[model samples]
Target: MMIRSALAGLALALTFLMTAAPVSAQTVRVGIVIPQSGQFKLLGDHVRQAFEVWNAGNPGVFSDVVEGDDGCTEQSGKDAAAAMAEAGVDIVVGFLCTETLAAALPLLTAEGIPVMTLTVRADIIAEEAARLGWKFFRLAPRAGSEADIAADAIFRLWADQPFALIEDGAISGRELVEAIRIQLENRGLKPTFVDNYRPGQATQPSLMRRLKSAGVSRVFVGGERADLAVIAYEADYQSVPLKFMGGDALNAPEGENPIPEGTIAVLAAAATSGPEDQAARDAFAGHGLIAEGLRIPAYAAAEIIGAAATRMTYGETSLQDLLGQTTFSTALGPVTFEPDGERREPGFVLAILEDGSFRRLSIEDTAALAGDSN
Candidate 1:
């Protein structure tokens, strides 16, 4: 009788072990770095939300997230990287700002942790990440794409109409406006008026008067949304026919139309909502979050990372090979990045704000553009 009892106990223990074994491997470990607090917290929140949305419907088991808040600062970024490195996570994702990402690179690379960044910094591939041979990937298009997208839209709308370019005294603003200038010059048209606007000052009366007096009908703005809004408002207040065109920075202008009703924009957003996106958008709305901008890009990045993670778990491939060789089907569409981490597809879009939302204008086919991409 004692012998029989011993055998039964062993059977029960084996059954328990079998059940718990699969459960223990269900959640993969991953480290997430984002600005959970500070100036960029809203964008960070959207990143987290996008990951959660992707996790809900993806085929992988799940990931146990170890979060690090970079707060869009260099010190915070290092601290966040140190925390994640200490956690012994297999991979690190996020780092949505240049300041934080730049600071954290050495730390992450020292530990041989793969990083998938959501921020668009061209210098990463061209200079730092490439030189170091670090396993870092940028999931967004290069900043230069904003210029190409904006120029394409402007060329379509006013190839004949003389336009003016204005910028604030910021590096990003200068780059944006200079892109417009280069594109215009390439097409044999020089801007009639080129000037700079003060970023935060409430009054642009003198600047507005100058543009109007110059008889400029269209103005391309490369500055803060609030500043452009003030300019647009002043133009309307004085009955000036100046219309503003710009990149996605214009989307942040609060309250109402910051530019004229027919103003055009080159949006950074790659994903346009479709039937497949309804569930995610609805889920986001249910939680009082808007799934836009960084959200969609984050979702696409998570999809790529999740798929690679799953394969890595199965020992089928490594993250480096998967990232370099594969094309991911994202909510935006099929995406493949060049060796230099530039996205190898049509990455920019043109849209006009209508009835409080961006209504995209039909342009060249993305597939054709991708085919012709250098």
Candidate 2:
């Protein structure tokens, strides 16, 4: 009888251990894909640091991190993806180059792993994702989103007023201006003047003269800071009263020709501004690094990945479903992914140049300015 009781007790204990093992021993592996070597290594380092800082703050969130270097090349990306799949990571994040990411998607998808890219903003990625059925998510806005945001802001503020669309003839500027023009036209609007001006000139007096003759009171300049400065300078020189707006390039570092006061800019808001981003910013600052560039976005990616992993581990939900169905609270702000894995709303804001820096424009303030313009 004593032997029988002992055997029964041992069997009960073993059963309990077997039943609870999965719950207690579950581990989530996260794969990090970035250019670990090459010219882009500095960017990869920043991303890795971001993940480290996040992990330190939230211990035990990720059981293990598998690192793979994309090398910012097609072959390297394929190798990296294969390694991540072989390691059986739950999800892979932190791609920088479009070339690398585009090359790696097929392999990662075949392994049934989701990807959240920190910096690859090429629109083709999203389009390809839709067509190819890739499980992809993007944290950065698409490249053309700059023009879309700029055009929307202009249409809101200066649509009623006489406005002109001008470019510097560079591919970046030309594409931006052309896209803006198309967006505005689709909205049943047209520019009062349209032209391309030669960039890098000492003065834009001729451009200013033509703008004045066309009665363009507002102009969207798709060009560099120096060219815009010269345009503003010549506008003042030739007594052409014009209010200028430009894409994010307007927020570039001040050169010899400083960005004029009152110039409107559609720029990405600086990280760590509000309370939502404060903790991550503090984390970066603790490591003696500023939360900027790819750093903050990578931090935001960490937040999303951690949350998704936690949910998928406990609940009866897959990582891809969690990513697509949920709205993640990130350092950058609330991030919601669309069904197609693109960011639902791009985080671009209208700002004004004041005191050599860009200050975010409030909605009320922007509306009031538009009213004044009209």
Number of backbone collisions per candidate:
0, 0
**Least accurate 10 contiguous residues by lDDT in model 1:** 365-374
Q: What is the lDDT of residue 373 in candidate 1?
A: 28
Q: Best candidate per TM-score, number?
A: 2
Clash pairs detected, candidate 1: none
What lDDT would each prediction earn against the true structure?
Answer: 0.72, 0.84
Clashes of 2: 0
Query: What tens-digit string does per-residue lDDT give for candidate 1 at 175-194?
Result: 88898789868987688889
Q: Which residue runs does candidate 2 get wrong by more than 4 Å? A: 1-27, 37-39, 269-272
* Global fold similarity of model 2 (TM-score): 0.88
Q: Report the C-alpha displacement of residue 323, candidate 1, in angstroms.
A: 1.4
Pairs clashing within candidate 2: none
Q: TM-score of every model?
A: 0.80, 0.88
